[model samples]
Target chain A: MFNEYLTHIPFYEELTQPQKDLLAQNLAEQKLSAGQIVSSDSTSCKGFVLVMEGQLSVSMISQDGREAELFTLTKKEMCIFSASCLFLPSTFHVQITALTDSRILVIPSPIIAKLRENNIHVELFAYKTMTARFANVMAATEEILFVPVEKRLAKYLAAAQSPIKITQEELARKLGTAREVISRLLSSLRREGIIKTQRGEIRVLDAKKLELKM
Target chain B: MFNEYLTHIPFYEELTQPQKDLLAQNLAEQKLSAGQIVSSDSTSCKGFVLVMEGQLSVSMISQDGREAELFTLTKKEMCIFSASCLFLPSTFHVQITALTDSRILVIPSPIIAKLRENNIHVELFAYKTMTARFANVMAATEEILFVPVEKRLAKYLAAAQSPIKITQEELARKLGTAREVISRLLSSLRREGIIKTQRGEIRVLDAKKLELKM
Candidate 1:
């Protein structure tokens, strides 16, 4: 019944037949619509969540209601926030929201904890995933501290294949800056002939120049 | 023979007698002098290292030679970098340097891996340590992005029980900013009678005002 989602996760594929059967029997799948909050700062993790489809934005909102994007989780990636529950009893400090229609496979916390206890491969996979996410978070912090906004914006643009169909306000939220800041930076890039900004789209005119900015 | 160091680590206390004996037989200790490089950006991790004494600084250097402090590892803390090696063959992107004369216990990668496979408690402890470290790194990142230098400085002062004994350059490095910037901010704080700056010390005069800055 759960063969599709189970097979989608690489770590699940590493499990033995019996272990796979156990997980398949215990795991539950939940579908979330776009803009739906999957979890909040105070929410206790239900289980280890594996993304089978679509994207989830992991962010933190400050006391004054400012939000900062930490990173995004897409298909085949496991949620580090849930894995963190196995270790400490502290509440999660970030909020996870579905950026698109998403399907998530959740193995109950107790089952995951038991599997981690009994399975060496499961334990190692969990450790590795947590470590990689930590590294990525550190890199994000470094980028915010050292890299200029123009360089960051250029890199973001270059990552997209063609014109990006994202609004300035959305871009601002992703970059952890104000909308006016993004608009001013985009205007500067447009003036320099580096990018052409439309009503709701931004087209990279000179990829080489944008790369140089990074 | 390894009782002293093993007893120092809380996780080691939970291991069975046979498991402890196994670790004692396989683990090796090494002493490093201050300023010595523990690991570099491209070095493959040898094993899970436990700091038995002193401190280690983990930082990343940019192409232009700017350095950003990530976090530090002190006594009884396991090296999360080595745990990361269990996943894929990827190089560590940060440098680890001995901040003081230090003693480290290394359980060879294979030995640690084998133990993790056989021992459920060992696996759980590893997961917990990795999770805690990830949380810390994220908090550090958040401080750098969301908090201003003055507020960060104020918080640092509030955390310390007494006067902070550090140089301006060291302070700048810790805050991930320029020495000149720290100097200017300190001067302003001194003028406002919030803190008194000596050649190598910052004595907070008005703790109440300092807390308000944060």
Candidate 2:
């Protein structure tokens, strides 16, 4: 049963039979409903979280209560934030929320520590994955600093399916801006016939024009 | 002689004598003058870099020539970016420069790979260090997105020693903004008697005032 999820992870292929067995024996399965908070604020580590199904949104909150989406983890992706807790007893300042009904696998941190100790491939896999996530976060930061919001919004829309099911306030939080700013931008886009916005959804009317914006 | 640098790395203490001998034998020492570029675009990875002396500045440059400092690698710190190159071939978008005359230890990637295969402690150390750097980069990203430039500049001034040697252009690049904007802000701060600027230097006259801005 666990093999289904394990098969999707590229790192599992490199593990020896005993190593794989150890992993299978130690992992605990968890089911979470949509909108559930997985971890938040000073939460200690139970283990490494691997999303077997559904999406999880990870966000950072400022001291003044402002929040910004860092990135999202989906199927077969492991939580890089959880790995940070393995080496040191540190507070995880970020919050994680399940975006849909999800099935997750929790590998005990000590088992992970032991696996990393014994298996070079596992260690390498973890290092490479964590570094990749770091690079992605850095790229997102570059986009926030260098790219215009219009372009960012357009890119977000272009990548997303039509009829995006997100509120202006939520979009604002994701983009690190105020709801009014997002509303004003959407209003301008609506005037240009690039998109149509309703109470809790946005539909791209002209993807070509949106691409131009990007 | 290499043992001096090895002693500074906390992970070195956990290695067995044979592991330490292997590291000392395979490691190479490199000397870099201040202002030297350590790594740049499309540079292939030869090894993991460990700073044994002085500091290294890592900054990301955007397509339109905007630059932002990611973070600095100081003594006993390994370059996580370099390690990222070992698993897969990818362009390094960030440039690393020696902040001062420096000495670094280069551990051949193959040798490090071999050690990791044999020594679990080495593997654990690499994983932990990479995760730590990832967290630091994430924090820097959060600061860039949430904090105002004025506050960032103020915080920088408060933390810096008097008579900052960097030019306005360099400072602007580090702050992820245009030089003219930084100049204008500095002029305003100068008029308020918070800082004094001359040629390519800035002297914080009132740290308390700067802290207030932060």
Candidate 3:
């Protein structure tokens, strides 16, 4: 289990055996059922978790009473508050909810902080990982404004390598839009000869043309 | 001149003597009139510049030919690069251009790398500064998508604590929109008693209503 977690996180793989052992000793296993609030708003985060089994959705409530999905984390993924946990801050900004039945290895940030103080490699590794993650989020934000929603949907499909096979409600949650809006856009794209979609899966038929829109 | 630069940056007050000396030794002064490209696309970045006078717009062009302004740097501010600048294989993705008559201090990245290798304190200081800047950018991104454009306009106004005196073009650049679009929105807001504009200035009349919308 420990090895599998390390394999997905390249930085963790760089740690010496003893270092990994230290992390492993503090790792506590927990299971979260689908739709469970793994971490809630206004709660002080005690530690970060490594996804061993399921998916976690990072989201926040908009003033309009809608939940906006910021991002999602699958197996081997992490969250922003993972580092925030060590910083002794109160009240997290985002609420993380388990999207599916999942198992996670919870690692307290205090322990990680200790490891950082003692291990040069761990500090560098963690810093690099956080820095890269921050850059990805920033790039995503740029995409949201510069790229139109339809193109974003197209690129999301291209990256996932499949059209998300979920109900309209679920799709809206993922895309951060209304189901009617998504259905309308999908129909428009299909008419434009950019994509072909069945019940749940979507395939890009004209990548050249579709990419031009992006 | 040094005092002006230090007054603009929050960290200048805390920097060690050696760090300040290193920066002083490495800085190369540059003059750029409004609309001049400081760093163009298709060119490799040698280093970043510290703005000592006027404003510089950091932006990227999308596939569809729209320009998205990431941020603007002015007196006492520096624009290094995204983390991808170091690790990504692509050439510079954004172009830095002068928005007004400006003077800037250019410091090559090689010098920073060399200093980092020999000075542990300097390395840590650099990492901390980058991390904090990344966090601010991340917050700005979240504010954009989740918060309405008017709310965003309000936050910017509040932070600026001034009338919307910045040109509509500059406002669009900051908000990542077309100047025409920003003009239409501002007109609507003005009609609604949210703000008043004359010439180049904008005065906020209802911060509460603005916050409510956000």
Candidate 4:
């Protein structure tokens, strides 16, 4: 019955029948509410989790309470933070929150261990997925260092949906800058007729003009 | 004969004799002079490499040619940039340079793939090493975003050998800022009798006072 859920997994088909049966039975399904914390640095992961639906944001908070988004996971994406304990004995320590109501599939660490022992491809899949996250993290480093906040803001607005539903503080955290900095830039854009700012949402007024900033 | 080189690797003991023999026979030893380019994004690495002696700096250059160090490798340290192609089909693209005369051991990608096929521990080592690098890069992100240049400057001075052999321009690049920023900070430090600067190096004169800045 649960085998249906495994169908969406990239590595699921590589498993032999016994391996598949073992994993199917051990896989756990979980549902999360929007804004609920999924995982963080403190709670060591017990299983490997894959996002089945909706969105998840992965971030790290500083000792003084500043937040920085590391990456995000969408439909059919695997959250390495949950499965990081498999590759590492210690916690990977990223804070994961359900950005929207989300559904997830989890496989117990023991089951993954058994599968990895029997199949090289299964192990390779883990390595591949881990490296994929590394790519995103590295790209974020490049963006944070090389790209200016103004250009990043323009890019963010350009990529986002109309009337983006995020508070100034949240947006600031995403771009790794002070809220005041983003507020100043957003105000500048508002004056230029590039974007409209409401209480917590932003509406793009000129997408073409925004591209110039990027 | 080359089997002696494998002894320093963290995962070598986990391999069976046949696995070790296969790796040893395939191992290639190479020497590099100071300032030699070990690898770069353009050169897709031919093999997994290990630094047997001397130092290697891993850095990424901006499109405008500003350089930033990602991490460094010394004795017994594995160069993941060389082996990244195995985990990823494309180049990982970090520039590697020999900081001094160095000795490196290389095992062709085919050998690593063959070993990974048979040994989960060997494959796990790759995953572990890759994740370890991820940790450093992420810490760098955190530092670059949150730590002030003054604090970073102080910390850099605190860690290095006396008479640090780096120009202000190079130091600015290392700290992810303009050369003038580092120059201004160094001048202030010089006035405080904390350090003395030469044409290309700065000698630490007051280590205790530098700690206060950090």
Candidate 5:
């Protein structure tokens, strides 16, 4: 299972066989059922979650009593919000919930923090992962505030085109808008034949029109 | 001068006197002139810049002649963007400019990285600072994208405060809007007695109305 997990990450391709073995020894595997709460906003964040098999949704409760879906995680992706658990007052900013029966490698934050010392490659990788995550969140926030709602929806469709299909409600939560508003906009887009949705999954029919909308 | 720098940072307040002195000795002071690019987009970003004596503007330029001012740094504030420089490709995401003749302490990033290994407090401080900065930038980006231009302008004013003294160009850059649009809005606000400006200084005559506008 650990070796299979290694296949999911890009870093493994570059590592020597011995290095991979070392990482495998450091890691432990755990299985989570669908709907499992990986981390809660009130709980201490101990370590990041690497999805070996399954999916997870990152969410937060807004002041309006709405559960906003920030993003989704699937195989090969690691969740770094657990790094927050290393600091005192380890309240998680977002909650991670398993969207499917999942197998994950829960590497303790202390061990990861230890690896950061004298391990330039791991440290750099962690830095890149965290920085990219923050940048994406910031960009999404900017898109929601400055750009038109239609454009924001279009961009979301462009970026999240795989795995756990996104619904209108999910899109609304991610965009920090109301479901009714997103439903209305989706209706308008449907009329214009810009996108098509089956079940909960949305498929973009016209990337060019979406770009134009942006 | 070193003590002056240490006193300004909230995280360093808990440090013993000798610890502060030791850290201070390693920092190198540099002076920059107005309009000078202190750190470019491609240059290796080394050392955290401790603004000791003047103001600086952090900005990113788009290919379309659009410039976005991330924020201005005063004596007590530190550059959050530089966190990337310490580990990643060592290049700055934004160009930092000395808006005024400024004296700054350039504490080498490598040294800080080394210190983190031995000092848990410093590591904690670094983590908090980076996380908070990322959160602020993400929030600001969300505000800019989802909120109306008027609300964004109001937010910028609320952030800078009255008498609002920043140039229309600066305000426009910060709000991601055209200078003409900002100028027109400011003119309307001036007409409504919401704000008053003399020379380069602005005073909010009625902050209450501005909140409503926001």
Candidate 6:
């Protein structure tokens, strides 16, 4: 399973045989059910997580018990937020949960850090992913603080190339708004003939009109 | 100036003399007045920024012309969002502006990359800062998404040990809320004897009450 997981990453071809062997020797497989919390004991987080199947959400839970999701990962996706423990080991600020029944391969910290030190491809892959995700998260912050929900919803719809396969709950989580707010906005969009909402999917009917909202 | 800047960071002692010389050789300095945009040509952003003096803010400007601040740096701070260009190397997303008359040291991308490759301390510094800032930005997102403005204001107030030397405009930017809202909240806190607001400073008078709000 670990070898199979290794092959799925973009850096596999760029890694040395010893690097591959190092990973294969250390990688552990974790199976999670839907809604399972994976941040306990900080064990799973003291390394890197490579998602092999299903979706996982990395989020922050505030003092009031409200969850603010950072990003989600599916197959072939890696979460370096897991390795955040080694950096700020005393504090556990990030949470990971199985959004669906999932399998993941976790490589302990020292090996990943070692690979990053010597392997150009691994380094690039890690930094590229880290910076991009961080920027996206900040962009999400800007959008929530500055952009109105209507414009945000419209822009989201306009940006989609096909019928958006999303639950209202997921959309609410993505937009950092409540499900009722998303339901109301979808109803409004439906009334305007701008989008067609079916079970767990939103199809844009008039992209031009949706763009206008943005 | 670059050598002077290097000594301020915790990792300076860990860097070799050659690493120090390389940084000093490549580092460039810039002087800017308050409100000058430093993110142009992406020139200032092509490397690492070491804040020698004054404060700089890294923010995201949305399509609608509103600013959402990501973080701010005072003395001894560095902004790596500039190096972000080397990775994405295409899109421009973050903006850095001088919030006060400021001087900063810049080390171009190639050299910084080289240093990070060989210097464990430099590598750790870069990743540590990147991950910490990214987490803070995501936490700010969580605050905006789930935290009420009043509670956020209270938390902000309670966290201050001395008189906060910030203007309403700066505080508004930091919290990603409207200046008027901060004004109103401050006034309410003042009226309730929970705090005292002077011309450009907020002095917390009742810590216990302020903590209660949080």
- Number of the predicted model whose lDDT against the real structure is largest: 4
- Per-residue lDDT tens digits of candidate 4, residues B58-88? 8865566555678888888887677666675
DockQ of model 5 vs. true complex: 0.11
Task: Write the residue-wise lDDT of candidate 5 on B140-202 in tens digits.
Answer: 554444456787787667667557678877776567655656777888888999888766677
Q: Give each model a TM-score.
A: 0.70, 0.69, 0.65, 0.74, 0.54, 0.68
The RMSD (Cα, Å) of candidate 4 is 5.5
Tens-digit lDDT track of model 2 for B87-189: 4334337777789999988888788788778776676666657666667777766676567778888888888889998898788768755565587789999
Docking class for model 2 is acceptable
Candidate topping TM-score: 4
In candidate 5 chain A, what residue range of length 10 has the lowest lDDT sum? A84-93
Local distance difference test scores for all models: 0.74, 0.76, 0.66, 0.79, 0.66, 0.75
Could you tell me how far off, in angstroms, the CA of residue B49 lies in candidate 6 after the best superposition?
Answer: 2.3
Instruction: For candidate 1, give the DockQ.
Output: 0.23
lDDT of 2 by residue, A3-39 (tens): 7778765678887889888989998998999988787
True contacts kept of 5: 0.05
Q: Give the least accurate 10-residue stretch of model 2 chain A, judged by summed lDDT.
A: A83-92
Q: Give the per-residue lDDT digits (tens) of candidate 3, residues A88-189.
A: 223225567889999887767677777767766555555555555555555665565566667667666666655446565566556644455577777888
Q: Who is ahead in lDDT, 1 or 3?
A: 1
Docking class of 5: incorrect
Misplaced by over 4 Å in model 4 are A11-22, A89-92, A110-123, A147-214, B9-22, B89-91, B110-123, B147-172, B177-214
Residues A131-205, candidate 5: write the lDDT tens digits.
556656545444444455677777777676543387776776577555656877888877888878678877788
lDDT of 2 at A167: 97
* i-RMSD of all predictions: 5.0, 4.9, 5.4, 4.2, 7.5, 5.2
TM-scores (chain A) of the candidates: 0.67, 0.68, 0.60, 0.71, 0.62, 0.64
Weakest 10 consecutive residues, lDDT, candidate 6 chain A? Answer: A84-93
